[model samples]
Target: MLTINCPWCGPRDETEFGFGGEAHRTRPADPSALSDAEWAEFLFMRTNPKGLHRERWVHSHGCRRWFNVERHTVTNEITRVYQMGSASEAAETAPAAEQAPATAAIEKQGSRS
Candidate 1:
């Protein structure tokens, strides 16, 4: 099972979270002006990079809040977890010891205070 680090609630089981989507996606500034193909591209296109991919996740059963995770797709190791709009450079470079504790499942539902 994947151990996802929740920015607000700490490390919890992957079952407690919901995968939002690929991170850093830009929305069309003028959606109404776009053609069907443009809209489709925006909706369907996503980066499937093999390493160091960033993605959004929500702590559903714990904090019920959303955050971003910089994870390695090949190893399924989460390198960093941060808030939605914060800078991630520091977390990305920090050693594993400096990163969030990436184990220990949620003891119970709604356990976070």
Candidate 2:
């Protein structure tokens, strides 16, 4: 019974959204260079934290936009959500990426329209 607050569709049941693995996970620049052990670690290893965690999530049943989410696993509370752009956009907006959290971005984007 998890209620996910979609940036576009308001809060909805968790069933409507799909879970993405750990966020901010950058792929190796040269995949072919990595050994089997390294590749396996990248594919299977993850930080299953007890508190706040940043992860990617998609609104499957609503807007269908992929966004970053900060969730608390213990209480199932959503702390923040923001549109996680592609690599180029992320690199270009590094300053904004540092200045505000996802919640602020969501609000600002909402107000502009």
Candidate 3:
């Protein structure tokens, strides 16, 4: 079974999470200014890269919070995991799973208030 590290919930079985599609897909600021083709492209176009892919995921059975995941498609190896608004570049280089001060521990500490 593949282990996915959730930003808030820590490492867990893949079954506990929900796979959301590609990440960083920003919505157009001026929707009314876009042509039909441009709108359609934004709505439907997605890169089906065979190598490393960045995506969104939700810890459905755990924290129930959404986060980002960088995974290799062919090997199904998760390279990194981070929260939605975290530094994507940093997460891509160093996965939260391997970081010393994990966000899950921080979150746990915060909840004691």
Poorly placed runs, candidate 3 (over 4 Å): 86-113
lDDT of 1 by residue, 1-113 (tens): 89876755676899999999898788999999999999998999888999988788999899787777878999998877766653353344335324445323212111212
TM-score of 2: 0.72
| Candidate whose TM-score is highest | 3
Off by over 4 Å in 2: 86-113
List the candidate 1 regions with Cα displacement exceeding 4 Å.
86-113
RMSD of each: 9.5, 7.0, 8.3
lDDT of 3 by residue, 56-107 (tens): 8898998797877878999999877756654454455345445644554222
Residue 10, candidate 1: alpha-carbon lDDT: 73
Candidate 3 to native Cα RMSD, angstroms: 8.3
lDDT string for model 2 (1-113, tens) is 87777755667789999999888777888989999999988888899999988888898987787777888989878877756765566556556545543334353222222
A best-first ranking of the candidates according to their lDDT comes to 3, 2, 1
Error of 2 at 28 (Å): 0.6
> What's the lDDT for residue 52 in model 3?
87
Q: Who is ahead in TM-score, 2 or 3?
A: 3
The positional error of residue 18 in candidate 3, measured at the CA in angstroms, is 0.7
Worst 10 residues of 1 by lDDT: 103-112
